[model samples]
Target: MRSEHDPGAFLDRDGVINVDIGYPHRPEDFRFIEGAPEAIRQLNRHGYKVIVVTNQSGVARGLFDEAAVEHFHNHMCAELARHDAFIDAIYMCPYHPDGQVERYRADHPDRKPGPGMILRAQKDYHIDLSRSFMIGDKESDMKAAQAAGVPGYLFKGGNLVNLIELILKQIGRPLER
Candidate 1:
C-alpha cells in the first residue's frame, strides 16, 4: 500500500548529473551534464524530492577519501543552487568487495544493484515508492530501482531537461509551480 507521502526523483550522480570522468573527486573535475541543473529545477517545480544515489567506489579503491567525495558533492550543490535547484539528499556507497581499503572492502547493500540506498531514502523521507522513479545511466541503477519497487529510466546522455520533460509526460505528472 502506498502512503500519501510525496513522490521522489532518484538520480544517479555520475553520468547522469555530471560527466563521468572515472573517479571524479576533485571540484575542478565536476561538470554538470547539459541541462542537468534545469532538469533538477524542473523536478523541484513538479513537487518531487530530488535525491542523488551514487556509488563512489573511488574511496574504497584508495583513489580518494570520503572527504573528497563530500567536497565534490558540496561543489555540485553550490553550482546547482545558482540555478535555483537543489537535491534533497544524497546517498553514496563507498564499499566494494575488491576495495584496496580494508574498512571499505565489502559488498555493501547500499551499493547499486542492491537497493539499500533507495530503500533507506524511502524510509527516511517517507517517500511513496509506487509513485517514485529513478534516472540512471547504468543497468545496475535500473536493477536497484526494481529491487526497491520503483520505476526506472535509463539516461543514455544528452540534454537532461529533455529527458526529464519526456519522463514527466510519460508519467502524466503535471508541472506545478
Candidate 2:
C-alpha cells in the first residue's frame, strides 16, 4: 500500500541538524550544521517530506522539560523558515528507562532503538518506509530505522549538505538543482 507521494527523509535532530552540545533545549544553544538548511530545502524542492525524529532524554534526566523541548522545536522551525526550508513534523522520545523523573522513567517505544516514533510517523503521514531513509549519528538510530524497515545512514559529523548529496547519490537519486 505504498503511495508514490510517500517518500520521506527522517532526520535525527541533534548531531544531524544541530551540534550535539548535550541536551540543547535553548534557542541560544542551538547551532545549525553548515548547509543543513539547504539540504532540507532541497528535500522540499524534490517533494520529499522532511521529518525530524529525535531522542530527548533530557526531559527524563531532569535537564529540561517537555515544554522547553517544544519551545526549542518552535525556534528551530522558525530558523529553518528563514531559509525557506521546513520540517513536515517532529517526533521525539522524552522517556528513558533510568530517568530521574518518575513519570518518564519507563522505557518507551518511541525511544531510539525502538520503532514507535517511526511507525507513528508512517501511520500519521502515510510514509513509505521502503522509499524513505534516515540519517543519524548513533547505532541506536540505525537500530530504530532497521526496526522501521527504513534504510539508515550514519553521519560522522560534517557538512549536512554534502552528506545529503552523498546519500542521494548512493541511493541512485542524485540531488539536482
Best by lDDT: 1
Clashing pairs in 1: none
Please give each candidate's TM-score.
0.96, 0.94
* Model 1 C-alpha RMSD to native: 1.6
Per-residue lDDT tens digits for candidate 1, residues 20-93, read: 98988999999999999999999999988899999999999999999999999999999999999999999999
TM-score of 2: 0.94
Tens digits of per-residue lDDT, candidate 2, 44-68, equal: 8766779999999999999999999
Q: Give the range of the ten consecutive residues with the poorest summed lDDT in model 2.
A: 168-177
Candidate 2 residue spans exceeding 4 A from truth? 172-177
Give the lDDT of residue 175 in candidate 1: 40
Candidate 2 displacement at residue 92 in angstroms: 0.9
Q: Write down the worst ten-residue block by lDDT for model 1.
A: 168-177
